[model samples]
Target chain A: MITPELLLQELQTAFSKHKYGAEPGELYAPIGYIMSLGGKRFRPLLTLLSASIYTDEWQSALRPAMAVEVFHNFTLMHDDIMDNAPLRRGEPTVHEKWNANTAILSGDVMLIRAYDLLLGIRPELMGKVLARFNQTAAEVCEGQQLDMNFEKRWDVTEAEYLNMIRLKTSVLLGFALELGGLLTGADEASLQLLYAAGENMGMGFQLKDDLLDVFGDPAKFGKQVGGDIISNKKTFLLIEALSRAEGTYRTDLEYWINAADFDKNEKVQAVTKIYEALDIRTFTEQKIREYFEKGLNALEGLPAPDGRKIPLWQFVHQLVERDK
Target chain B: MITPELLLQELQTAFSKHKYGAEPGELYAPIGYIMSLGGKRFRPLLTLLSASIYTDEWQSALRPAMAVEVFHNFTLMHDDIMDNAPLRRGEPTVHEKWNANTAILSGDVMLIRAYDLLLGIRPELMGKVLARFNQTAAEVCEGQQLDMNFEKRWDVTEAEYLNMIRLKTSVLLGFALELGGLLTGADEASLQLLYAAGENMGMGFQLKDDLLDVFGDPAKFGKQVGGDIISNKKTFLLIEALSRAEGTYRTDLEYWINAADFDKNEKVQAVTKIYEALDIRTFTEQKIREYFEKGLNALEGLPAPDGRKIPLWQFVHQLVERDK
Candidate 1:
């Protein structure tokens, strides 16, 4: 079996060697820059790892894996515009670096290019793969729309939040694994298990991100802790805190949420106090663990031998276990 | 042989009956609105016409024909956002009726949905068709970028202007025809001829539009006769006039172009005089005729019976022969 590190190295090398496109420098430059910004490449890595579980030719999955990465960055490029975010991966976002119009057009091309990459699949599988991709792509857009909708309303339920994230974030992960399995000639049952493993792990991954944004070491997290709290973001923790906080606890949380002007540090600290009282940190951790275990159970049930599955398990653990 | 009118009617009914999507009213409403706005359905009609040239079952091409239409509107939605265009087909553009973010997200889904329509193609032809669609799609974006670039440039040449429109407007028409031929199992040489006919006719169609914008009778034109001149849009007449005008005419043309503020009608009159002085109308008309004839010749070269070819011939002539 290829080691996880080798697989990632292979992925990075192939990615660096590939070019998006050039010309009409305005439309193509931002696409190249965003691809070069280099997020975790976690989606592509999952794609390769999933393929490895079925066959030794993991290297063959590289281009389709890059398709997932490109599609993800395309969403980020557009989402940054919608969210009015100025930064990504500690760098200026595409819209910030170029402009919104350039980002919009470039993002559109990236999506077309993603479909182009999938065209490399064997003809018999191409239509099936594209059908699934279209479904996933539409779901991601729906997820984004729902997330934006939540911004105006204060009464969003936890189920709604989970569903929103599942559509926006998790389904692509599911498709990534499913695509890998499809490419490797895995049976239908194995493909379902692969998709389930990725989906559950993606949920854990997102929940862990929510936890880290509040409780992680600021230096280790690579961003300001409590940003979601500061921005009044409707993350899982905030949804739970709102539903469970009562009396003075509810009053305090509401006060911070409604505050238009205050010392940022003071508000974060006060909210952290309420979260501590509610035991929200431990609660979130427990939920994250549950999702991780669920994903692991799915991985365990796959028909592949344990030796072939170990790399995938290690990778999932690495994603979820990032510095509590 | 199906007449052009019958082919167009069939395309319209199939398109009207085919829905984009529903739910998340914000995300889908604008899509439905734009699709329903009723531009001539020209692209899809050309697709059906091209299919009928080679086979009697042109009805089989309807879904993929709608794919071309959907992709065309998807570009218009995002381009309206980029151009800040307020209207399309005399109705509020998607971005104007809904917000830009709505337009962006919905436009993204429209593209994915276009690919979904293509999934109905036979498996053997799916990859080739998609590959061509990607190329055509990328060129269209490139064309849009070039057009935007021209806005800031005072020295755009006529050649550059034609190339830009060819990329922006002609290739999709080419692909629309080419896709029909591909669907009907037309041989590769005939597909090229079909593509050429649509492309050349598209060039003529755009040049005719440029011509009518300056020279068409105001009551019949359906738009301001000299809107291009008032806006100093770099159309064929202006580009040719710039290259050929001399002395007082050159100075006058430059003054109007550089004028910060002026009466719209006065500017239009001044530029129209300069275009007439250079005989640009005759020049533009000649170019339009050349392209139309070139397209007709390609259509004539098709191995199909002359009876089968006449409808396509008449359609190309109608598109380029518009007086309004």
Candidate 2:
């Protein structure tokens, strides 16, 4: 089987081969712009690697793998509009670069294009694939809505937050792996295991993101170390701390959260101190480890041989070990 | 084969059978809301009627036919946001009823649901149907973009306007007919003919809408007659008048277009008089006739017996004859 590195190169070539640009420059420009402003291409790579475990014909999964990536960007484009976010990947968002209407319309086209990308997969698989995609797409939206709904409330629970992330962030990752398996005709049990693996890994990845936001070296993280704390963004650490904080810890968190004016660093420092007092770091790390272990076990449970599973195994290690 | 009237009832029943309501009512309530604020179920009716042309198995097309209706409402929901229109079907628009973010997210789900509706069709037909739906959906976006682009320019030509309307309003109608034929395993030629017939009829329908807005009786039209004139909206008559006017006629047309303030009735009267002077009504009627006849011709050329085609023929007459 081709290594993950080589499969990624092929994925790049596949992406370049499919142009998002078309007439009515306004509608298509942002699609091309966002696709060009690349991320890790993490989801598609996972898809290809997941397929690599089953067959050497994993190259055919590249285009369908892109469906996940395109759909990911589509959600981001709309989510940015909802969040009224100014920057994405350290640059202006589609809504900011153009306008909300442009972002909304362009994001819409990106979604339709995602469906277009799925067309050439095995015809028999198309119906099931489409059904899964539709369900995931709806869940993502529901997740966003729940996330938004949480914003207006002060009592968001850890369970609620985790489920939100699973729906909003993790399900697509799960779908990515499931799609690859589906395309390769992986057995029912295997597909389920693959999806569970990705979903668990995704949970670990999101919690890692939470940990990095408050704890990682800013230079390596490439973002403010305690930005979420400063913004009082409800994250795993915050939720855990909120759930566990007692007496002064609770008072300080609420104080900073409700403060009308305070130094950004001071608020972040205070929040960090409270999280430490609450053992939030250890708590979050333990949760992250649990998920990562569950993910590893799912991968182990796959019917593929240890040799065939080695690449995916390595990729998951790399995923969980990322500092930023 | 079932009659169009019965097909419509079946379509309504099918629509009710599939609830848009789900958890995270925030993301779904708008879907149910918009679908419930119903209008003429014209597109899906054409789908079923077109299928009736081919076989008695047209009843099998009901669920798939709902796809076009769902897709049509999806466009309207998003377009309502982009146009900043406060009302749809005489009710508050989704964005107005909830919020823009709700509208955007709910609209996204609606589009995905449309894909879900298409999934249970013949497995072989799923791909072609999806491809066509994707293409049509993109054209609708492009057309809306062009329409928005025209908003900033006075130089938009009659041809540009026609093409834009064809993309925006006509193709989906064409797709509706084509989708029904496709679901019935209609031959390639019949599919093409069905699409073209629907496309031409769509053009006529849009033109007739343009004509009715300015000329139809207010009570009958269920909207303010001359509302388009009041807004200076670019339509068949206006585009034709803009292209054909010369000398004093040009001055009057330009004056009305540029006027910052004018009495609504007076402006409507003046524009109507100018249209009469320039023969814009006759001009628009001629264009409408051309399209409707082309649609009729396409229908007549279909390889179906005349008796079997009569329901579709009668339906087209009803569509063209609508005063509103």
Candidate 3:
């Protein structure tokens, strides 16, 4: 059985070989530049791995796998412009490196490129794949909108936050796995199980992200620990604290939330203290575990689970348990 | 025969009937709102009208026609966000009225809905229609990127600007008309001619916009006339003046181009004088008429030399001759 790392390397190799348009340097150049800024290549790797469990020739899923990566990058390019983010993966974002308008236009073309890639799927399965992709894309946009909307509202509930992240982050994971199953001619029942597993695991991953934002080691995380707290971002911890805090605790939380200026350590310490008092960390950890368990159960329920399924499950477990 | 007004009315009627999802109030509300803020509706109307040229039941083309309109609006919503423009058709732009993130998400859904409307197209023709639509969509993005690139360059040529506008604006118009022909099962030759006609006419239309931006009466033109002049945007006239101006005129043009703040009217007047001295208006008029003639020739070149072609040509002529 191939390790996830080996699968990822194979996908990356395939991606690097796919040629976009040759001319129109303004358009294709940025695409190549962004794709070159390698992350884990997790999405496409998962796609291939999911296909591998059902079929020996997972390379048949490569085009669809590329679709996922292209779509993912398209969103990132546009999101960076909207967020006014200067860097991505510690490198200048497309907008910052090129320009906002170029980023916008390039991102738009990347979306078309995704559809072009999807067109390579078997004609018999094209409609279902496109329908699924359409839903996933719209959900991603909705999730982004909700994330932005949450910024202006002080009353965002934990459930609402979870739903937003689920939409924004989890649906693609679901689609990635489901697309692989579809490509492998898996039955609808098994496809559903895979989708549910991906969604549950995705939620667990996001919750872990929130946990890491507050409690992660800065060196390992490659960013400031408690960065979300510093930004007054409404994460799971803050939402829980906001929902469960008492009079003085609520006031203290609100003070930190509304404060114009304060010592960074003091603010982080105060929020951490409040979160501990409310038992928010423990509550979040329990929720994360629950989601992971649910995801694993769903994976186990897949009809005629292959021997390689254990490694896939282990891959997700490792993701959920990561400190960073 | 339906007048352009009746065609536009039909489009609005069809557009209004769409019951977008459960969050219909907020999600789909913007579609109606923007559609209500009426522009010429020329693109979709042309689509419907072109379809009518072959079949009397142009009503059958309503959904695809609406797709064109919806797709147009989707581009506008995102473009407004990118341009940071505050107005559309003399009303507050979506981003200005709501926020950037909402506009982005709403725009994303609008694109999805465009596809949804397109799915109503006959299954046999769906692939062809989507392929054309996808190609046009990507070209539009490419054109927009080129336009943005032009902003930073001091040496953008007139030809480059024309090509940019051709891609950004004209290709969609060509696709719009060609889509009409495609839906009606017109011969490929006729469809190609229709596309060429629309492309030529569209170039003429955009060149007229550049002309009107400076030369048209302020009230008649809707927006502030010469707004482009004040911004020193590299319009056809400015590019011509920059290329042709000798000694003092060249120096003065460069000075105005570099000027930080000056009397708006004076600057407009000075640039207008330079353009007049170069006979840039006449030059642009000749170019516009050349394209219009080419468009007419293409329309005449259509497989069927039916009398109805005269009215269609007349409709295009009327559009070109409009003051506003």
The candidates' interface RMSDs, in order, read: 0.8, 0.7, 2.7
- List residue ranges in candidate 1 displaced over 4 A: none
lDDT of 3 by residue, A1-324 (tens): 667777887888888898765546888888998999987777777788788888888889988888898989888987888788999999999989988766866777787788777765665676677778888887887787778778778789988999999988998988888888999899999899889988998899899899888877888998888878998988988888988998999999999998998899899989998998889889999999999898888888888656768657657767767888
lDDT of 1 by residue, B1-324 (tens): 588899888877887788767767888888788888888888988888888878888878888888899999999999999998988988988877778889999999999889888877888999899999999999899999999888888789988999999999999999998888999898989999989988998899899999899889988989888988988889989889888989999999999999998999999999998888899989899999999888888888887788877777778777877887
Report the lDDT of model 2 for residue B141: 90
Instruction: Find the 10 residues in a row with the least total lDDT in model 1 chain A.
Output: A315-324
Clashing pairs in 3: none
DockQ values for all predictions?
A: 0.86, 0.91, 0.35
DockQ score for candidate 2: 0.91
What clash pairs does model 2 have? none
Clash statistics: count for each candidate: 0, 0, 0
- Candidate 3 lDDT over B159-204, as tens digits, reads 8989999988999999998999999899999999999999999999
TM-score of predicted chain B versus true chain B for each candidate: 0.97, 0.97, 0.95
Task: Give candidate 2 regions above 4 Å deviation.
Answer: none
Error of 3 at A43 (Å): 2.2
TM-score to true structure, per model: 0.98, 0.99, 0.90
**Number of the predicted model whose DockQ against the real structure is largest:** 2
